[model samples]
Target: MSSILAHNLHLEFDFSYTSFPLVSLSIAFGVWLVWKTWKLITISRASLPLPPGPVPLPIIGNLHQMSVTDQSSTFLQWQEIFGDLVYVNIFGTPTLILNSYEDAKELLGVRSQIYSDRPRLSVAGELVGWNRSLVLGKFGERHRTMRRLLARSIGGKHAQSFRLHEEFAICTFLLNLLEKPRDLKLLLSQLTGSVVLDVAYGHQVKSGHDQLIFWFRRIVQDFYDATAVGSIIVDMIPALTYLHSYIPFTSFKKTVATWRAHLTETIEHPFSRVKEQLRNGIARTSYVAQHLSEGPLDFETEDALKYSSFNLYAGGMETLAVALSTFFFVVTKYPAIQQRAQQEIDNVTEGKRLPTSNDRERLPFVEAVMLEVLRWSPITPTSLPHRLEVEDIYKGYRIPQGAVVYSHPWAMSRDKRSYTSPHEFRPDRFLETPKEPDPRLFAFGFGRRICPGKHIADDTLFLAIALTLATCNVTKRVNEAGDLIEPIPQYTMGVVAHMAEFDFEITSRSDDAIQMLTAAHTQLGE
Candidate 1:
């Protein structure tokens, strides 16, 4: 019955040539329209302008515009010209500079999974074998394993366990300042190196002549030499790293080989010491000792232990010293700030005793001063480069995969948007109503790669600040002619920025402070 109805209604197909022309034209037009739309979208995404950067020159890219010595000021100028995110090409490698908090927070913090990888340092990391250490290690299982090991050893809650190490070291530091105050930098290095070595390995540092300290000094210098900007040709041309043995440049090759050897010795020295301590049944509580206390580990795990342990302390030592040095420099210049800090410590200790870790909560002003120093001159002015895992887009900008990224703590510290009177050294900003955000967040870093030793560094810095203020008065130095030697706030540029040497007088605040310092030193029994 349906067939009969269709037959009556005459539902006919339009397959004739006359109908084909219009149908074909319509289909072709629709296909063409679709192709055009897709082409526009693809072109837009591919050419998203790369976050607004200076025009790069051929081959050299933006390297000509960059001052290898002072990337901080250069990046600051770029931030002024092109907002927060500035992209540049270094040689053939793509790089993105993040000068603002929000941009860094979003990329390095919120989206860390894709932004947590460190850049490949050919000469330093590969040729000199520094890549095994957690700082320059590639992002992968090894890094994760190291992070877990570090977290268990000296992270957040566990950091309090090392209070004795910090206290003992600081006390020694105070005595050194009293006995040999002229070499402040050397004293500080000893202080930091001792504390870190004692905590990271079970190695107790001898005052001035510990072999481990010697190795540390040598290795850190080697690190600087191997990683110096544009100094090693291999870093820019990675392929040269393979030709080290055959390279005609004997001096460079020999230098790199020596650096590699020093790094190995430095990493192994403390680890061997810890093992020896364990074997002799006199192991001190430390990251290495604690791990070794567990049943024996396989080569991979033990290797991870050795390298991660070194990174744990070695990474913090120089940076902590720099932060403390900056603290002294600031106080020497602004005696009022130092006095205020002393007053705060006195309020906590009542001038009857040396300030201890327990007094940390009670000494807010001291904490503020530490924070201010970090903000004034971030130990690491530039964040270690983080390479992107995949190509991405942000704010209509296309960032290519493998584009190494660097966040500027120096820029963030001086950002008017986040700080008021950014140039001023105001500790009150951290304490006053509607307080400023703690600089530690960005200063330490952001995301998965944020400093694992941050907690320990914080605890260590606060104690050093508190103890020094409570016991000593840092003042301007006088020349041979008895003229005032004013300090100028200046810093050296490198991976760890250090305050330039300044003459300052550090002496006991009072007879009581001297007695207390004496008592603490005696308790050390050194």
Candidate 2:
């Protein structure tokens, strides 16, 4: 009996040991199967096609191909090579350029929920303190609040109240042109600055060298220069932003610091003055004074108000200045077009009065010319980089979260599908096909982030163009040797795309025109 029990126990032990090895092998095989499945899924995701683009280099990606001053033109060339949607990598950042209107409208407009966010501009927005400014603010509750306030203050009918400011400013500019034709660009800049100051802070800019104008102009110019693509290396290589403090005598850092200080002052100075005016019962109909009059505001609300006001001041002044300057440059080059515009203005107003907003609808040709000028040279070509807030697939390609997207208005303006003979500056194109999309739609921008000041911009530009053409004959500057030195149609490399400083002759078209401008300026008490 003892021998039989020992044999049975030994058999039980042998069976238990063999089952343990089989169990271990089965467990190992299960883990391997799971891992293989996971890896295949990962590979499938990685293999999803990205948008067509030029192959990037190892580390720098496509940074070498970008130009700091002329990124729009460069992107346009790439659009031709890679079709409408071109993907590029700047360092590790995936940049998607929307070259066509349909693509831009689809991504930035139709699906704005995912594409409304602004790119994190480490150099321009953060370092320069423009993140507080509405133009560069992130997509959030703060942005929404500021945008709503801005829309209420400067949009639609509220924009029309400021038309008097524009009319007076343009009339003053006309007189300045008569006295100092060579200073046409300077006069236009001062006029825009004056109008913006009055609208934003109720402060009249009395001189070209007004301290406020000078500081704001410097701030705007430097901000554009500092924030421009490829302007600061740290923007492309984000790690370097933290390292900036460790390096001694960093010029860019110093510049940014100075800019931040100036920017703060730009926002606070006029606002404080307006508030003081409100407190003293001498407040005017300025944006700040009007808001302050509503009652005391909390810190956050007040802060939003301050930055929103700065947005109006900066955006209104700089963009209008650039657009009006571009008009002068383009019309000076194309005399026949200028003559045609002047004829239209003459027929509309009969040289008895300066052009006003009431005349805008009747002056379709004049409006078309304004549209053409905007299309010919879009002020903000890429319309400030937008960021994808979530992962999205567009046209069978994955657009990962945080990818920088650009709506290339410059390229869209020259689209053959949209405009016939797109490169040529033809105003009649708008009149030809009522169905054809106005370039202004793309020029202003797309989606929820379209320039909030578009109404003000449109009104200001129209008045400037009509009144200037009505009163003045812009011709090439004649040298002492009696030769007409035609101004070169060149543009500066910046966010606003200003026409390069060029010489032109500005003379009153007729005595009646000068009388009309003088009478209008006198009526406005300027």
Q: Highest TM-score among the candidates is held by which one?
A: 1
Which candidate comes out best when scored by lDDT? 1
Clashes of 1: 0
Candidates' TM-scores?
0.90, 0.88
- Tens-digit lDDT track of model 1 for 1-526: 9998777556443345558889899999999999999999779888777788899999989988887678888998998999899989888889999998889999999999999988888878877888888888998999999899999989998999998888888988988888888889998999899888888985677668888888888888888877776444567876665564655643466778888888888888778978988999989899999998998998988999999888866688899999999998888999999888788777777878888878778888888999998898888889889999998888878999999999999999998988899999999999988899789989888898989999889999998988888888889999999998999888788787888898988888888888887788678645
Lowest-scoring 10 consecutive residues by lDDT in candidate 1? Answer: 9-18
Q: List the residue pairs that clash in candidate 2.
A: none
Residue ranges of candidate 1 with Cα displaced over 4 Å: 1-44, 230-232, 244-251, 524-526
Q: RMSD, each candidate, Å?
A: 5.3, 7.9
Candidate 2 has a TM-score of 0.88
